[model samples]
Target: MEILPRPFDAQPLDGTSTVPKHVQLRESLRSYIVRSGEPGAAIPSERLLGEYFGVARMTVRQAVDCLVAEEVLERVVGLGTFVARAKVDLHMKMTSYTEEMIRRGMVPDARVLSFEQQGASPLVARELQIEIGQPVVRFRRQLLADGEPMSVDENFIPAHRVVGILDDPPPTSLYSVLSEKYGLVMEWGEDTIEATAASPSIARLLNVEMNAPLLKIQRHAYVARAMIDYSVSYYRADRYKLWVPLQRPGVRSPRAYSSKRLG
Candidate 1:
């Protein structure tokens, strides 16, 4: 990995500036990363940065900490901080993980952690629009892309939706199985995303540090008008991002309406 060169000739932090010193330092570091650093390149030590900028070591640390939280930098215990790799952006669309990875030219895989039939709790029942304590097939799996752990998915489906799903092993993409085997096509889905901290088990599974940032996604999938499954997936925040396209309300594309309508 190429080591990022320090910007020794940069102007010192202005004392009269209203912005906090740490924020100024952070912006400088961010620019340096963009211009000079590559993924895994080591950043300058806090002590060295402090001396270079004539600031307290704590101030340097604070700036570095913010970058770490943003995943622009990562710190190894024995090694110093280094630039982070780019994250994968998942556009807001109704697609299976397998399909998405393939679209990105990545090979996708899944390891089934556990699979069982159980009585649904109130939350699961409500999400699947079934009676409380109804029979449900619970499937837990870990998703990987190019052999790197990506996310953990836990899904609950009403027992009647896909009969004999539990008889065989779970596939990497549940949607594919539902479509091919049961003829139950997932036509649409709704998702909610939030930032969260990794749990101990999640950290271990994903090979990340405990309490590291994670992206939590909750989804409800439907076939026609019937709810089919409810799922929650925890994705590594440093490795993944959610993206969506927005359009102003009351705006319509020219193709959406015929030109004859104007006449």
Candidate 2:
């Protein structure tokens, strides 16, 4: 959670003022959140809030309770309160998994589970723009973030471009490696998202209950004239949410909502 400086122009609460000091403090904080695009953010602790607002800790607790009841913030069992990640706008162009993790201020990581040459099936061949039964580089990983297990990533790259990568698996950002080593800087990709029941593997890796609904992302990434990667990502629905923003070119844009979808 981030804390900006308290504003100086805040009108001090007087005994005769109808609004309570705690309420006024909360309102000021709420406005700061809106302007900073950090709504639902976990603010400072109750003691710190009380100190900043010149109010009692109980008064600060009252304001926090009100906000929590309204679902503006959430408290984890062991972790402190944090911004409730609720928004899921589907219309916007999808970003890379690594990119999304970085945006949320988390360090995304991956463990190479397996890497080897694989024979492409008809469907895989079509997706990678290769012939069936051709040798393709298959790279699989147990994706991680902040040292915790995330979804699994199964990706395929053309064998010719990423030679010997399967033999000498490296521990680093694949995107950065592709850009510097293979000169394959992916510019864009198309992803198809769907709701699917979690597979046994997914349930195990994501630590989710059996048969839980999960978001499946199937993507085909391209670079230069060849297909760079075809990846299938299964995100843990309970621990994850997707947020996107959409707008039309040369047109006035309307407000996008911050809520989750059933899918």
Candidate 3:
């Protein structure tokens, strides 16, 4: 992997240049990070960077602040600034959280927050195509990656279909268990994603500040036209991104399109 070039080695800022000093410094730092090829690597101290660049400490701070705001870097209270992890890109597909993280080379973990059989709410009933007040198994869990919180997922399944699932340990992949134990293979699903603010409880659970931006995903999974899973997940916007591929009508194949866009 390449290492970051020393700040002093960067090209000197020209006094007569049209670009602002802070912007120049920010670009330089960004280049250094890209060349370094190190995610979560600590950056040089602001004071040292200022001295190396012959700029005021405030100017150096401004440069670093820009990178932090753009999520190219992150600041830890006492640990200093470091390169931010690449956000997980979730493409439009039916997949389990475990499968998604594994594809990204990250270890996935889950902490069950709550699990119980409860009467389905009106909305849940509608989504699952079940009667309101019908018994349903509700499982709420915190999905983690590399020991860091990623999303809060709440899933509801018809209790009758998953007879004694509660008796077993919480699974890393709910879909896997559903298939292996209950012979319910989720073949297709639709997801609706929306931007939302973190509620106080959710903020605490996700380790984000209250009102932080979040991506709320509502999913309905089915097996042979039978609605089996209704899940609502809230993901930290800073750490996750959704990718959807679009094709024009009458396109014979994906390869026939010259340009595919992500939404």
Candidate 2 residues lying further than 4 Å off, grouped into runs, are: 1-103, 252-263
All candidates in order of TM-score, best leading: 3, 1, 2
Report the Cα lDDT for candidate 3. 0.88
What clash count goes with each model?
0, 0, 0
Best by lDDT: 3
Question: All predictions: root-mean-square deviation over Cα?
Answer: 6.2, 9.6, 5.7
Write the residue-wise lDDT of candidate 3 on 231-261 in tens digits: 9999999798787777778766655554554
- Judging by TM-score, tell me the better candidate of 2 and 3: 3
Q: Give the clashing pairs for model 1.
A: none
Ranking of predictions according to lDDT: 3, 1, 2
TM-score of each: 0.71, 0.60, 0.78
Pairs with backbone N, CA or C atoms under 3 Å apart (clashes), candidate 2: none
lDDT, each prediction: 0.87, 0.69, 0.88
Model 1: C-alpha RMSD to truth? 6.2
Q: Give the best candidate by TM-score.
A: 3
